[model samples]
Target: MKSALYLFLLLLALQVQGQHGSKLNAQQQEQKSPHSPEDQSQAEGENSPHIKTAPSNYDFAFRFYKHVREEVGNSNIFFSPLSISTAFAMLSLGARSNTLDQLHKGLAFNLTELEEQEIHEGFQRVLQLVNDPHREVQLSMGNALFIDDRLKLLQKFLDDVTNFYYSEAISSNFQNSPEAIKEINNYIETKTHSKIAGLLKSLDPETVMVLVNYIFFKGYWEKPFNNLSTRDDDFFLDAKNSVKVKMMHQSKPFNIHRDEKISCWVVEIPYKGNAVALFVLPDEGTMKQVEDALLKETVSNWMHSFTKRKIHLDLPKFSISGSYDVKSLFEKMGVTDVFSDHADLSGMAENALLKVSKAIHKAMVDVSENGTEAAAATVMEAVPMSAEFPPPPFIRFNRPILMIIVDKVTQSILFIGKIVNPAAEED
Candidate 1:
């Protein structure tokens, strides 16, 4: 019931947040763009089960996120207690369809009562709003959920939250590094459509080394699947059930790894920035059955002891691209109390009092035998991740806020970051 309520609120938020679910722009609707029952994009085949509310799939994704968050040292110092408690509340309230409205009320209450210095400074204490441990942690979780199909909406949310804290907390130190400033600026525009503008001072570009980390995966398949032999095959859902799916097939030499303890295979595909998709297909015959039987113990044993072999490989030549507001996404994962102001945030900055502003994420994955292409980017620092103030004092950030990231070793940023902050930045 709670899950259903969350889904409803999600749909409602989409509508209220300007997602018309139509290609027709707002201005176009005013002019009354022609509407036809059939659409050109629909000239394709049936819509498959891609975005269904599957618990296992969702859990897997979030687990991957949690693991990454924990991997980023002192993860506990990221959010203040207030934010932690608020996150808890959000999780509980998410079960209710009217949760979004309630969250607004709760956030307003916190903003009025709490106080913070840097919002998230140096990542230290858990005493006040500005430096609260849990609050910043919740905010930093945004580190992952930044990719989104709707980059504009994602930018708006990003801008709102960053401005919330940095409005007064942030300081300027351009002498840190000029090349760093240029690097950061270039990356911001490239990643976020030029909406984000300033994230560093020329003086301290090396600061990036302090707060940044990266992951690059690349791979090549030993056996390539042939397009000619590829056909729609019956993929068993359960030993007793099955569904017909387009499965690519080919006979070639592949370093196929298998494990008897946990039946599966290791297939890899490399991409531009050393990114790769390592697929593990189970031999349980039925996908649903295999998934149901999956456990960490089995997975570990498979990864540790799987034997390599040469055999014919069958796969699906397909792509799945998706994006979501991860802030709300994690709310469903049971961390609700952190968004509140009545909480603590003394760890990140000089003062205490802070909350998450947004959490945006996007991903695209394509697979085949000869090779595969896949990319995943997530940013959840905020969804509705902003600290509300009465009309916000002086919007010194008249110019677009920028974010850039580069691998000094590679002289390139495989990924860039951004936050729109305001509608004005859209220009």
Candidate 2:
């Protein structure tokens, strides 16, 4: 269960807001807090030779992705299911009875197969592994609970969140002070490296607690694209429409596979560590078919089929950002009780009638010849093949294509989205 939440946190790739240059030095990196008992236990679990993940875990992730895709429509879509689910998991920590059951079912957790304790433990282990300072992946997760000072929260709930999720607790005057809104937004901005702004516009007069989760990831490609080769090129939006884009060119060996069943080409580009960006390009008009057939099994098969091959790749340099209110999305997924008056969050406070009033998410990603510079925060050169050999197969992402940044070892998707028109001015 905890593994799922860790995967939930991995969905940090949603398009947030601003575009910033990632230029921080290693010395300037923020240090994690001292380890607790939870962290130690998580470490022990993570050191195992093989990582075990239940199939339902990926099913839950892909199901959530499908819902987001449907809601966002055909335009360019970017969201971190990990970010959304992490928030829900934290909320579920304080939920009880029917409310708890609804959250588990909505998030696609198999209640009969996994107990509650196991779920939380899985999350702890994943979090600890991802937050390891020694890892080369540039990733960080932050959670904050803004509560109305008038209502005293349960101490045990606060402690559990602190120990298990490493969330920061803050007290605020939601009803009296409008500054609470600013404070909350400011905190989110800092945590997300200013990628997301105005996360909380206002607060309800009776809002007992507001929970927020923010994750930022930045990594450079193991083999970077040559910046000099980047030039203006046409990106086909459709059969008759196209836009000029700054396409980055490279000719090198990449982990690629051709799926005849879906008529699509799948490729994996490794990052500095266990993370990688998987790009799926469908044949001409077969994008819809590929999307419809998307599943954990499909991705697993692609991974297994991947073989190092020489190819000339031309990918456009693009940056995308998006905002969403996922309350309706969750409602459509049959998670309505948590937002309605009947919400049972009594475990959070005594004699409470608590329910989530808002569910907001924002994400952004930028891909260039250098690598990636998103909300989190760059350079590499691909070695060209020998001139004596015949020209390698060229793969130009001239149209809409699916992209996912995943942790290769755990096979958890951190961010998933599509670049319909990389050069399109609008999101």
RMSD of each: 24.1, 6.1
- Winning candidate number (TM-score): 2
On lDDT, the leading prediction is: 2
For each candidate, how many residue pairs have backbone atoms clashing (under 3 Å)?
Answer: 101, 15
Sequence-dependent TM-score of model 1? 0.35
Residue 399 displacement in candidate 2 (angstroms)? 0.4
Quote each prediction's TM-score: 0.35, 0.85
- lDDT of candidate 2 over 1-427, digit per residue (tens): 0000011122234332112243342333344344532344346554331133335556766787778778877788777766777678777888888889989998778768666766665565556666666555677776778777667778888887887778888887776647887887777777777767665656655666677788888776766676667789999989999999898777778999999999999888887646788999999989889988888899989989999988989888888866666787788889987777777877777656677776877788878655333322224444544584656778988889999888654446777888897765643
lDDT of 1 by residue, 330-406 (tens): 45554343333332322222222333333333322223433211210121122254555432221111111111121
Model 1 residue 254 CA deviation (Å) reads: 3.3
